[model samples]
Target chain A: MVRQKVLLIKVGELKDLFRKLFVVILFLTAFLFIMLSRFDSVAIEALNKVVIKVTGPVMQVVELPARVIHHVWTYFYDISHIYAENQLLRDENKQMMILQNKVRTLEVENQLLSRLLNYVPPAEASFMSAQVVAESGDKFTHLLLIYVGNEAVKKGQIVMGDESVIGRIDTVSPPYAKVILITDINSKIPVVVERTRVRGILSGNNKDLPQLIFMRSTTDVQEGDIVVTSGVGGMFPAGLPIGFIGSINGNRVEVEPMADLSRVEYVRIVDYGLAPDAELSVDFVESEQNAR
Target chain B: MRDNWRENLKLFAVHRIPLIATLMMVFLFFMPINSVQINYFRPVVGIICVYYWSLTRGYIFGFFSAFLVGLIIDIYSSLPVGVNVMIMMLLVWTTDWLRKYFSMSSFGVNWLAFAIICTAFLLLKWAFLSLYFHHLLPLAGSGLGLLSTVMFYPLIAYINALIARKFLPQERIDE
Candidate 1:
C-alpha cells in the first residue's frame, strides 16, 4: 500500500524513494540471507532432489542406445574368443608376421623409460570402472560425477582415467558421486618428476594440466618428463599416474594431462580404503602463478 | 464442473512443473547416463519455464519459488548451494521488472531480453561457483564455456519460448 501510494504521488515525491530504494535493496539481501540460513540446505537440496528424480528416467532413456551397442559389441567379441588360447595365439602370430613392418610400440616405451626411469616408482595403480553422471568444469572447480555412490565407492578413493590419475572422491552423494577432477584450479597434489623425483606441488590452474611449481632449480624435468602423484600428501595413494610434465621453462613446469577429458568414459576408482589423513605436510612452495 | 476439473489439472501441472524439473535433474545426476547423451537441456528447460512465468505473472512464482528453482539446479547439477537459486531469483526479478517497463508486444524484444537475462544468470552463477571452488579447482574450461552457452542460448531459447507458449497461458500470470 505504501508503494502504491508512492506511485500515485507526484514524480517530485519519488526523489525520496531513491534513498528508500537503497534501504529496500539492503533489506532484501538481508532477508534473503535470513531465509537461507533458516532453511539450511533446503534450496540446493530441494533442487538436487528433483533433478535427480527427473533425470533418473532420462538417464535410463539414454542408457538404451549405449546398452544396445555394448551388447552387440560383446556378442561379437565373445564369438571371436570361442577358439582356445593356443589356436588364438597361432592365428595372431600369422597376423603379427604380416604386420611385422608395423611401427614398434617398444620404441615409445624405451624413450619414455629413459626420461622417466630416474623417478619412476614401482607402485602400480589399479582402476575401477565408473560412469560420469555429472561434469563441472566451471573454472572455479572442475568436478566430475560418477554413477557409483557410497555403496560402490569410499572417500579418498583414487579416481583415474586410462592415462593418468584424476582426483580423489571428496564427497559422495547417494546414487551419485562427485569426482574432483585434478584439473580443477583448486586441486592440489604433491607430484614429482617420474625421472628426477624433484618434488613439487602439482596444482590445477584452470587448464587441462596442473602446473608443477617449486621444482628444485636442479630438477631434471624436460619437455615430456612424466609426472606422477608423489603420495607425499597422503590424500592420494603414492605414485599414482598424474600427468607428464610439459615444457620446462626454468623452475616453472607446465604439464599436459595424460588423461584425456574429451571422450573420457569408464573412469577407474581405486578402493584406497578409508584411512583418515590429517592436514597435508608438504609445503605449498610459492610459485609463479601465485606471484601473479 | 468440467471446466473446474480442467482448471485443477492445469494448476497441478503449474505447481508440479518444478517438481517435474526436479525429477528430471535427479535422473540426470543420480542415475548413470552415458556421456554421449549429457546436455544442459533439463536445466535450460526448467529455467525457461520459470522465467516465462515470472515475466508474464510474477505473483504466482513468488521469491520462494524462484529460490526453489535455483536450489533444484544446484542439487541436480551438484553445484554449490545458493548459487543457482541466486541466479534464478535475479533472472526472475530482472525479467519481471523489464516486463513492467518495456512493451513486450513484439517477440524480438522478448527474445533479446531472454538472451540478456540468461546470459547474466549464467555468468553470475559461474562467477559465484568459481569463486567458491576457486581455491580447490584449477578454473579449467572456464573460458570456452561462455562461448558454448552463447551458441546454446538461441537454440535453448527458441525451444524454451515454444514450451512456454504451449504450456503457459497469458491468463495464468494475470490471475
Candidate 2:
C-alpha cells in the first residue's frame, strides 16, 4: 500500500513538471514566432501559404450564410427604392450621353497628338477578376482575402474596383491571395496630380482618407485635384485612378480614394510589367548612340 | 462489462462539448455583420469560449486545445502567427489559476471578472502589436473592442450556458 501511494505521488510530480515545461515552451515558441515573422522569415511564408491554401475554401464555405443574408437584405433594399432609382438613372443617362460624346472627341484629339509626338503607349494589361472572400481585421489593419490563388495572381499586381485603384496583392497562397488595402497603415503608392502633374507619395494612415506627402511647397495642388498612379516605381501602371484630394491640413493633404473599400465586393487584378525608369534608361542609351 | 462500455461511450459523447464550443465560437467570430462600426466593435467571442471551458471543464480543456484554437484564429484573421496562440494559452493559464480561488456559482462575479479580463486582453494585444510593428498605434480601436467585448459578454455567456446545459449537463452538476 505504501509503494502504491509513493508511485502515485511520483506520477503527480512528473505531470506537474511536464505542465510547467509545456507552458515555458509555448511562451518561447510564441515570442520566437513573432520575432521571426517581423523580419519575414522564409519558413513562416511557406507555412502561411499552406495555412491559407487550406483555409481559403473553408472560409468561403463558412461565410456563405452571412453573404447570403447580406445579399437578401440588399435585394430587398434595392427593390424598395427601384422606382426612384430608375427615375434617377434616366436623368443620369441623359447627362452621361452628352459627357460621353465630349470625352470621345477629346480622346481622338489626344491620340492624334500622341501619335505625332512618337509617344508609344504602355502595353495593355489583361485583368483577372476575383471575388473578395473575407476581411480579416478591424480598425487597425485592413486586409481582404480574395478567392484567386497564386496560380493566376502574382504579388505586387494592382487591384482595382470600378476602374479605380484599391490596393495591391501583398501575398498569395494557393487558392487565395491577400490584398492590402490602400488605407492600410503599411500601404504606400506613388501618385501624381492630374491637373498639375505634381508627384507625391500617398501614404496610408489607417484611416478612410490616406495622407499625401512630399508635395512641393510651391505646387499647384488644390483640394479637389484628382490623383493617379505615376508609374514611377514600375510596380503599378500609370493612369489608374487612385483618389482625389479631400482636405489640406497645413502641408498634410488627405486623399479620399475613388474605390470605396468598405463596399468592395469584386476586384480586377492587372499586372503592369516593370517601372518607367527602365524605359527612360533605354531611351537615354539610344539617344547617345545617335549622337555618337 | 457491457455497462462499463456504454458508460465510456456516454462519457466520450459528453466530453466533445468543449471542442464543439470552441469551434462554434470561431464560426461566430467570422460571421460578417456588414457595418463598419459593428465590424470595428467585433467581439472576441472565442475568448469567452476559452474562459467558459477553462472555468467549467478544465479537465478536458487544456493548454494545447487553447493553442490550437488560437492558431486557427490567427490564420483566419491574418494576425501574425503565434500572437493569438500566446494570448489564448495565457487565457487558459490565468483562468485555470483564478478558477481555483473563484467558484463558478456566482454569475455576477464571473461576469465582472470577464470584463476585467477582456479589458486586460485588449490592452495586452495593443501593446504586443505596437511592439511588433515598432510604432505607437492609437488605443481608440482597443477601447472600442473592449467596450464591445464587455457588452457582448452576457449574451455570449447565456448562449454558452445553454450549450453546457444541453450537451454537458452531467458535467456541470459535478461542481
Best by TM-score: 2
Model 2 lDDT on a 0 to 1 scale: 0.77
Q: Which regions of candidate 2 are displaced past 4 Å? A: A149-151, A216-220, A273-292, B1-17, B172-175
Chain B TM-score (model 2 vs. true structure): 0.87
Worst 10 residues of 1 chain A by lDDT: A276-285
The global C-alpha lDDT for each of the candidates, from Candidate 1 onward, is 0.59, 0.77
lDDT tens digits, residue span A56-130, model 1: 446557545655676698689878776776698899999997676453666567668877867543345445687
lDDT of 1 by residue, B9-108 (tens): 7776675554344334334333332332242222354455566657655655545667665555555444565566667666766876787765456756
What is the Cα-based lDDT of residue A8 in candidate 2? 100
Predicted structure 1: lDDT: 0.59
lDDT of 2 by residue, B1-175 (tens): 9998888788777777786677656755665455677777887777888887888777777787788777767766656778888888889889988997766458888888989897887678767777877777677765776788788878887887788778775544321
User: Which parts of model 1 have CA positions greater than 4 angstroms off?
Assistant: A1-127, A137-140, A149-152, A273-292, B1-10, B18-53, B56-62, B76-79, B118-144, B173-175
State residue A24's C-alpha deviation in candidate 2, in Å.
1.6
